[model samples]
Target: MPQHLTIVTHPLVSHKLTIMRKKETSTAGFRKLLREISLLLAYEVTRELPLTTETIETPIETMEAPVIEGRKLALVSILRAGNGLLDGILELIPAARVGFIGLYRDPETLQPVEYYKKLPEHMEDRYTIVVDPMLATGNSSVAAIDMLKAAGAKNIRFLCLLASPEGVARMKAAHPDVPVVTAALDRGLDDHGYIVPGLGDAGDRMFGTR
Candidate 1:
């Protein structure tokens, strides 16, 4: 319900998201749920993508069918956790370009520091979507957007599984131009900078790491 944020409320998306919130959900179950939810979420994020028609001969006759226009989209995952979301989106946008932006928060400073970034060429032309599971503190999200903007990415959208109110506010304040699409917007961040009632560390839950 927050401005500049799209909360996907499809029955299927909500159902899958409920499964992910439960602590007992196994790693495999969690991953599968995430993938399913990502597909639905992707549909919402790309709803406004520009389209053009190309005339093609059908079995019966030639017709103009709408197709996505311009350069292939750029999907930039925010390191390990983002990869999970990226995989499901790829199923829908198989030909989209892939990229990665890695950032880790310093424990003491609580600020994001970039460890790696490798993006596709012509990002300025392609519509870019940044993926991450949880938007808890929003530091990394802001930093990632900063990098994308600096790299000539003009149009960008943020996609995630869950988001905290604090994170949404932070992102809104930092980059109002970017629209955020997510399955659910949780309460807020806890003292430890974790989303309250969140599905826990997404990277750990998905990868089964301690």
Candidate 2:
């Protein structure tokens, strides 16, 4: 079993994913569906967030209400494609601290190459959620986690819209502790490293770029 993986099979998630998978889906439609699906995914990913009671006065009486505990959360988007997932998550967590990591695959070698990264200070003190729309080969995901740990982020979660079996296995082997929350786990990756039935380059679909 993939202990750390959580495939969000919620009806809404699956429904939107189906539309996204259709090759005829327009860029506008794809982007909108992604934004909606990501919000649902965010809910699943953060379902285990710790809560604390706070004293508050209601219209009727003073009471203790539950609120998230400790420092604010840190949301790390794994670059351009991650931004699609990040935008929707921000709608749900407007106050979360934001960070970005940019990585591009070397065309010939098919290896991830980091080009940019910026994270919030005191990362160890916050719960970090890394967002990306697709986890295909897992090279970028693993490398991103490596960077987070090196920067003192201990508690971390990986959130994505889609994953391949190969990607999930690779992530578990590399970072067994970090939970993986995705909308679907496809059959596997193709020879060229793309998820076999994935929606295709999420960044391109979302931004209308190749």
Candidate 3:
């Protein structure tokens, strides 16, 4: 309903997302839910993909089958929480190429700075999907996009588990060309800039840290 943003409320995804939101959920469970949700989310993101018909001989007769067009896609994960979504998406698109972009948030300024970055060759030619778990302030997500654009990626899509209004605004202003996909857009960010009522630090929750 929010332009390019697609919020999925499917029963299965909603059920797992609710569990992941619960404070009582275990680290392993959180990780698993992220994976499952990522897979489901990926399905929605690729729903409108172009398909080509292929002629194949069946056991009884020859028939035409539909297959995805183009070469393998490029999946760029904005580490480290992005890695969480990466695994699940990979399970669905095993042939997808994987890339990593590491960003660190400065506690005082609350800004994102790059730590590491690695992308595949011919990124400009491949459809790129950038993965991140939480799009709270959008600082990290914005930085990641800027980095990607600087590198040769023209076609890009941003996928996240949850997004805040502020983050969405920031992205819309910064990279309107890139569509964003998320499960839910939370209330907003807390004083510390974390998404209010958010599941806390995504990486921490996934790794069993305080």
What TM-score does each of the candidates earn?
Answer: 0.97, 0.97, 0.94
Cα lDDT tens digits, model 3, 1-210, are 225677887888878888998999999999999999999999887776668999999999999999877766889998888999999999999999999999989999999988999998888787789999899888999999898889888878899989999999999999888889888889998889998777889999998876
lDDT of 1 at 154: 86
Which candidate model has the greater lDDT, 2 or 3? 2
Off by over 4 Å in 3: none
Clashes of each: 0, 0, 0
Q: Which ten residues in a row have the lowest lDDT in candidate 3?
A: 1-10
Residue-wise C-alpha lDDT for candidate 1, range 1-210, written one tens digit per residue: 224999999999999989998999999999999998899999998988889999999999999999999999999999989999999999999999999999988877779999999999999999999999999889999999999999999899999999999899999999999999988999888778988888898999999997
Instruction: Give lDDT per model, in order.
Output: 0.93, 0.93, 0.88
State model 3's lDDT.
0.88
Window of ten residues with lowest summed lDDT in model 1: 1-10
Order of quality (lDDT): 1, 2, 3
lDDT of 2 by residue, 1-210 (tens): 225999999999999999999989999999999999999999988888889999999999999999999989999999899999999999999999999999998777777899999999999998999999999999999999999999999889999999999999999999999999999999998888999788899999999998
**In model 1, where do residues sit more than 4 Å from their true spots?**
1-3
Q: What value does the lDDT take at residue 109 in candidate 2? A: 76
